[model samples]
Target: LRIIKTVPCLSRADLADSFVLQASKEKKCPDTDYLSENGICCDQCPKGYKLIEQCHAPGQRSNCTPCPTDQYMENRNFYPNCRSCKRCKRNEIPVTPCQPTQNTICQCVKDYYKFDIDGDTYECRKCKQCGVDEKEKQSCTPESNTVCECKEKYYRFKNKCEPCERQGSSFFKSTMGNSLPVCLTLFLWESKVSIFYTVIRRHATGQWSKQTVNYCTHFYLSLSAPHSHLSIPPAALSDLLYTVLDLVPIQKVKQLVRSLGVTDTEIAQAEMDNRYCREAHYQMLRVWAERKSLAGVGGQGELFDCSLMQELLDKLRKMDLGLAVQELETKYGTL
Candidate 1:
């Protein structure tokens, strides 16, 4: 027979080795509360607020206060204070006006550029000078990128300007005459123009050439492939030569659209959908307003007066439109 005896705790030392050890389990804070280091469960402060007082014990609330202007709390926090808001430099402008949830986005002011494309880099870089083969397609502004396109007769060769040479002919031998089919030259022009900003060579030529071509001549160019050129209808030719230029600063473009009856301005409407381009449009608008000494209370609608918007609309419209078929045929040639 075996006799088993159980011992009872009578002193502090005995309690340490007691058969039935008891400990209060740690409590988990609910989603609405923060589990503090002191083991107190304190309710979370709302957004834009910071906790100033902690709960005395579990199942209690904390004291919070609204963050002051130029300061913000993005999330519910037990922090003693809100974070300081971001500010734009004197030379920089706010592209996105600051909000409680997001910081003010700064863009370099007019005639300036941000050298880096990296989003995290905050400094606006100096606007670079135009390349040798490049012309100012659009001037640099604080918010708009400097756009450059090759000058006439110069072609973009690996982004550098190289003189265009007519095929099967020398510089002197090559004439915009009958030797190079005017239609063929036009085909090359339409085929090589890239995304409204011309910078490509004929897929067939394998070399870059920039010479004035009869882009409107009643000729068709097959665009089904990257470099295939075939005779196309006059309408197709016009469509091929014209594109909704993506490089243009959109805000000034928008001014024209508003004056032209918004829907008739198809190109402008399409551009508004692009986030980067759309913001650039607004940025340029502010610069324009300042230049013209225009009064603007707030919002995009007040950017410019309706009566003064016609001239800009006409200029932008011409860039988006190519020569009509009848005009090309009457003056130029037919395929």
Candidate 2:
């Protein structure tokens, strides 16, 4: 095998030409400078044009050039460069600006929604809220999906529920079938107003002894249902009253029970059998007396002094009992 060194001291152009000529001769063809002759081999695309399509050769049209930013070519042509892209439609924001190498993009305005089943997305979504004069008819999350009932009291307007005031000839009231509404209303009234404790109904005339009995009963029932219906015989009421006014210490009750050595569960069951529900008015009175006497520095105010008050009222709309009773006393009780 023989190795040959290239001839030294030849000019760069002359050496290139000699190599081309030799290659042409060896291949039995004429030498042609394809890159320089055809005008395809430039260092970069000129200003206003981008190199989106790659070059095939120095002079060929297949090589180089596309439209600059914010432009596009609708159709292909003999020339290598492209035209600008179109602008987005009204109420639509562009997803991306037009570029020489890519397509234009856009979207719709917020507060205006357009559904698309095929998933070809092109717009923004809208917001949802209740209309004027219409209490929430229905609502939806992410948009419009709720169903609302009206507050119309007397008239049975299409979809609205009947209010208490609409239940009777003179006033709306809760009936058996509409438990939720009745419950909700009862909860609200009891929370906001007071009731009279001494009122006894004149069953004959639908009147009262010292105060309106229906209102008092309603108030009591709302605050303490199931138990409220229990007819507190004179004996029971008298015993409860005596127990409260005496202001006996709770620790004494515990001590008495402990002295008997009876299990706590048994005592609790006995209280339940008496319909005490762990919150007999007597128990609440004991707590109230204790708190009032001690005057703890950082206690939740008077009404909540009795733990049962909070425990029982939390589930209802209103959490006030003493105030409700007081208000009723002020409004209807003779004194």
Candidate 3:
């Protein structure tokens, strides 16, 4: 092979021209270069040695011994010697093809990605399961990850899928998202658009409160005569009263009672007289009174008026209706 020599004071173009002059006419020289000291060469570093520095002259040393495992050179060179390779980062595997002349390339395990996806190179992504309904149905891939979701029978809590606990309720993907609600909680029956709320019972304390429902719709609310009548004795009124106090805020009760002409003093007396009512009643009164700046001392002193009674009855009807469905399903399997 013909060689071109690089000399001092000669531009690369001039050297090429001179080498072409000395070449055979039939050689048809495509390209040539002068080997320079401390300069990178076209060939890779030989085994057991690495190019740490390059030669600028034709006869200067253009090769260096391999760097020790502890040191490595940062760039290609034919110099004194290569630096030691850097230690791999935690949980990172270095590419074996890299050498002292090139910086180390580290990659994380398959389970980890750089900042999940579309993240910075220094970050790592982790694997996670899908939502409850999709626990056995969904998965993740390297390029894209699965979104947490609620399965057909499961609901979501804090982005985690949880099984629907309320009987007669199941996870359903509504326009809003996957949620657990009573199957027919909002349905049209007999030309009446009925909506329902839930009351979660405290097994140990027997206390009840309205379990929030995501979807709220208008209902043709009505209360049965028996549930609306406070004259039936407090024992018979416990469940009905519990249901009422749970669903309607005290401010709403006050408004309904005021509409019936019941004085705040009477409201206060009824609260004090009822032994079975929970402390939640006072909590409601305090919040409502503080909010409305109503100085009147109605602590359930007087019974709620007939309309308030009607609200209680309507709430109970929904609860009882739900309970009936749950009972039937339990006896005969899901219906």
Candidate 4:
């Protein structure tokens, strides 16, 4: 009988060590070269060129061609084709033009910033402009938007800046107890109405002083002079009508105008007179307002009144258009 030799089986640890040794012993291509399909180390194509054919022998250069226009090859590589260059989108300006060896770099134009990303590119949006009573705290940049703050003597209200109102010296004395009476006059114009407040206060020492306080137009009308007839000017009335139109859909606006006594022919004529839908809607509302004024107690030339606004509000409520009604109430305050 022939004698048989037994071989030892490798443990898990021994197999792992064997794999590590094998990996360490394997040859790796240098940074300037890449391993070919034939297991040969071939020289790489330089930047701006793409590989057309592999090297025939080790240490030999590969066949390469320059990248076509609007294409790029950014690094020494073994790729068969060059990459396509990037293009700038709307509201964007090219920072660095695309070249054979590099991709295009883009940035937002002046008064715009990067708002979002679209795949591998950026989408730009217009910057915000501060209101008249506000000042810019930070200027807008390509990467960031504008920052605004209320100016001196103004306070922020509902995202807008409004001038601060002055109270009489007596009112301040009641609150602060050590103030002297001062005279001032404040005039404000709103809806073609010029309003000014004059207050006279008698001091404890028998001195007479006059004081004036400027209050917000809407606030004063709503609270202090509730019974006063504050007629809405024609321009202000037009703005409110447009606001109503904007709160509802176009179909709803047509329904509203019709309900307010605008004829189909009138709507068609308004459409012909205006190029835009919003302008046409405004025209229809204007006609409705004119008709209502003509039928009111005040004569044909009377353009605006509190009754007209209340009537419009009543019609909107009857239509169950709560959003439009709410917007008008919020803007005009109990009109």
Candidate 5:
């Protein structure tokens, strides 16, 4: 508690030297040596060097050597040998390579994979694709590979699970309208150059009986040449008529003339097809008809009218095929 001469600011180097001298006087290990695990002062090996020999006495230095080019010792230790450097696997890639004082770290290659949720990792498995009748459910990750599942239309076909074709041969539509291929032809139709209705061996790609012709509602003009298929392209009507009619939309239709631009040969061919379709539809209705009439069964009557004449010239004076088809089909029912 008595006030005496005090020195407050001491240089760092002199302060450290005084502290080391006092610590040594107290029997601590000197700067040249460190306390080993066995409680003896020994010369320690530096990182990247391993001890080749140990000292039995406190003042003797341990024999040390640098780790070999292909080996390492990452920390100071009394061990007598360096560890062998890690080698990359065939499917593994080095992230950080081995150095004098560092260990090599590696990971699975891009095309390699493993599914370890938690625990030690095993060898990488190669990436695989979903096979036939299967679809990818989950994409691959660095840790986990892809997952697959059977497709919605998977069915046993020709001894293997295969994708079902849309309403083709062997496929049938269920009551709920789910179509599956059955590998058998349920129905078919054959025509000339233009294929009519063909449910071939694969998918359900075919034609229908009545070829739809969309007449413009405003200009009262034919939008496109009539043909039979499932999808009707609606924009062609809007695009074509808008160019001519002051951009006004199409209106109600006129009583039919020959479809615009359809050739005479096509018209004759169309007449034959229509005659066949009318009779086919008529026979179906006759089954439930209280007053059945097989009037136009064999193309014997007029095509343009109900006149009983094989001479087609009478209707040539004024023929409207679309109106005539409507009148013929409604002879029995309203459809």
Candidate 6:
């Protein structure tokens, strides 16, 4: 028995496991304390306070101090310094002021919604207001935006709410060779050129109307015609302006107006005159339109005209605002 008491050789893995088991058996700091650099279990700094120095020995409290002004320590932590509090941005208001143990909470101001950029940061965006032809389906809230729908007897056509035409009005009807009444709508194309075509057929009930027919086809044909010098109707032009405002981003409004020859002083004046961002943008566009009209056509008192619209579209194209141009063409018929 004393001859061969050979010891079992330990592998590197076995040594590592034995060390890990020994480490696991060591006493861990309690929830209220943290392991300090000197291998001591130190009491954690309480909420509203930060650690100034670690405890010198086991079962001892760390040196701590209250968070400074505009700073916070939200939890029991052993951090060396407190976190700085956040400030509310423009169009935002503080919902809850910062306290030593808590951070400030912020929310969007009235008529604005919170727009998150990264997950940790956000800004406020102006809430959308429904147009005259649309009705509010859902009210705006801080977390969500307004929802709009076309009003009664109005339908969405090319992203705008247009009134449904009455029967036997706004278009001429003539009999074709097949005895079907062909609806003839005169559409004014660019540069005052007229495009006349039969776009709709009379229903079996003998009642035909623009709304009841394939109005989209008529719209396509009208816009697809060759360019001419036709002036857009005043109402249509107004709608186009609104549509342009909707299509152009709020951030890019200043750049757009500047490119369209609006001076910095005028832009600043518009900002002073209008409190809301949307109103300021609309006012700037109005100023740009009036100035362009005056310079191009000797101030006919028309804020918008065919030539002005063409020039605007050209400017937008040059500025790489193709979405606005495409939307304008889709909604109001092409220039």
Can you give the TM-score per candidate against the true fold?
A: 0.39, 0.23, 0.28, 0.44, 0.32, 0.45
> In candidate 1, what residue range of length 10 has the lowest lDDT sum?
191-200
| 1-335 per-residue lDDT for model 5 (tens digits) | 99899788889998887775665556556565666543457877888998877776667788899998989988887677899888876688888999878889877788666533222435666765767876776665445555454465443222233443432443333232454222222212111010112222333466333221111111111212342211113242223223212211112111111222224454455456556643322222222111111232333211111121111112311331223222222221111
Number of the top TM-score candidate:
6
Residue lDDT tens for model 1, 1-335? 99999876488766653432332135666788877655667898988888888887766689888887888877777889778878886568888876655567778887776443222444565665787766886776654445565676665433455554533221212234444422233224432321112223355858656444312211223443442423234454233223222323333366444443444344454555546765444434434433332332223221223222223334443433212221232222222
* Root-mean-square deviation of every model: 18.9, 25.0, 25.3, 19.8, 30.1, 17.8
Question: Candidate 3's residue-wise lDDT over 72-97, tens digit each?
Answer: 66644434555555555555567564
Go through the candidates in order and give each one's C-alpha lDDT. Answer: 0.48, 0.37, 0.41, 0.68, 0.43, 0.68
Arrange candidates by lDDT, highest first: which order?
4, 6, 1, 5, 3, 2
lDDT for model 6? 0.68
Instruction: Give the deviation of candidate 1 from the true structure as CA RMSD.
Output: 18.9
lDDT per residue (tens digit) for residues 199-230 in model 6: 55467899764434322221212232243223
Considering TM-score, where higher is better, how would the candidates rank from best to worst?
A: 6, 4, 1, 5, 3, 2
TM-score of 6: 0.45
Q: What lDDT does model 3 reach? A: 0.41
Measured with C-alpha atoms, the lDDT of residue 229 in candidate 5 is 19
Q: Evaluate residue 54 in candidate 3 and report its C-alpha lDDT on the 0 to 100 scale.
A: 56
Candidate 5 at 185: error in angstroms?
27
- Candidate 2 vs 3: which has more lDDT: 3
lDDT tens digits, residue span 96-138, model 4: 9999999999999999977533224357878878878878977
Q: Model 5: which ten-residue window has the lowest total lDDT? A: 187-196
Task: List, in order, the clash count of every candidate structure.
Answer: 7, 29, 38, 0, 11, 7
Off by over 4 Å in 4: 1-25, 117-121, 166-335
Residue range with the least summed lDDT across 10 consecutive positions in model 6: 213-222
